[model samples]
Target: MFDVGSGVSANWLRVVIALVCGGILVDIARHGVGPLPFGFAVTLAVACVFIPASPAPLLLICVAAAALTATVDSPFAPGVLVLLPLVHLLHLSCAIAALLPRRARIALAALRGPLRRAAVTQAVVWLMVLVGALVPVGRTPMILELAGLLSIAGIAVVVIVLDRAR
Candidate 1:
């Protein structure tokens, strides 16, 4: 149950987030590596707007978009790189919006810590991706495999540590 006083504000915030995310998704679709890659992103954004409490659909959409970006054989355009962090933010915003109760007085202050943590985590992840992109590496299959494995391991370790800390 929400602290009734803030329900309207909270719902408005949620709608705004959904709209911004949807807009970003549309932009991504417009400039995406391929038309199919971001098609789900826009669709999911609309779904999220209608059903803000269900965060999983938007999460899956984000994952799919990221996967498509990774697998697409496109040039490393600077614009795409800039769009990456915004996409991450949209995902974070959607998650936060979903958690908000429809009839609660959500203290904006209460969100500060979680938002800051999420931002920090996103920044770290983006930095890693940027570094990987900037560093020119041989596209040998063996090296690519090794790098993928290491990345997975690193992500697992980070997840475990974060869980423990929580």
Candidate 2:
């Protein structure tokens, strides 16, 4: 009785992403950068199953999750930083899975371009973070911190330009 067309609308996809992101934030609040609770993880899994019905929500959710995780967790936790891209991929996979038609046929071929772009974006972001980490900003003076803020602003501008060029 489940109709994929009805469930896979853009609005529904947004709702699903919002729910999943909320669940992730809750888990982070409860456990910090530690392991998520089984129940919450299961809930997220269920939410992901419906992601393909509206693919745009995945971007919003990923951005939100990355922002939240970066702000709430210690920057020294490289493991957590690395996991962000992996988590985004998992979400992407779940969204793609939701695209299966009523006949259970998956149009995965259509996703090749999008997936490639996403991978490239993730790689660039990870590379930037890695490079930034290599800089010895430890115990820097207030002036250095201010300069760092300016550098971050410059990076943001570059990202925006690159995104527009794409």
Candidate 3:
């Protein structure tokens, strides 16, 4: 997984680009050429190319943003500015998680080996994501958004820490 600090700094420009392009496409689709659904489609199209290959933390962040955008009233919904920070936070988280190797390695010299540690780490990551999603921070949409982002961040952090341990 990537480092929390490095992920944020490394992906700063990319995030900004995503925000600008996503927002513009959304706006144009929502109010001008097509509509919200159109904007969402465009956003998804762009993300398809970028998200999958990105670091895990970034992927989660992009997914969260897409999910949020998908459900909220429309593309860049009037009141969804709150999503900006939430997306930023999520991006940071995903970047961190992606730094881990595809195959895990054990850290302790006496441990069973790499395979076992990797499986354990993967399971732990899934559990963390589940817990993060289920835990409610507040009732507002913004609060919910933040909680989701934080949950993703937690998962990313776990991956980074685990990878570091190896």
* Per-candidate TM-score against the hidden true structure: 0.59, 0.46, 0.23
Candidate 3 overall Cα lDDT vs. reference? 0.49
- Give the per-residue lDDT of model 1 (tens digit) for 1-166: 4354543466766666666666566556555445554655656667766676676455745645575467555535644555565566666666666776675556777778978987898789778877877766665588867988999999999999999999
Tens-place lDDT digits, model 2, residues 67-133: 5565555664644564466567657655655554434532335567878988898989888888878
Clashing pairs in 1: 2-104, 3-104, 3-105
- Each prediction's total of clashing residue pairs, residues at least 3 apart in sequence or on different chains, is 3, 1, 12
Order the candidates by TM-score, highest first: 1, 2, 3
Deviation in Å, model 2, residue 94 alpha carbon: 3.2
Question: What is the Cα-based TM-score of model 1?
Answer: 0.59
Best by TM-score: 1
lDDT of 3 by residue, 62-136 (tens): 544555555566433642444454444334333432443333332333224643655576667557656766666
Local error of candidate 1 at residue 149 (angstroms): 14
lDDT of 1 at 70: 72
Q: Count backbone overlaps in model 3.
A: 12
RMSD of 1: 6.8
Model 1 scores worst on lDDT over the 10 consecutive residues at: 1-10
Winner by lDDT between candidate 3 and candidate 2: 2
Best-to-worst order by lDDT is 1, 2, 3
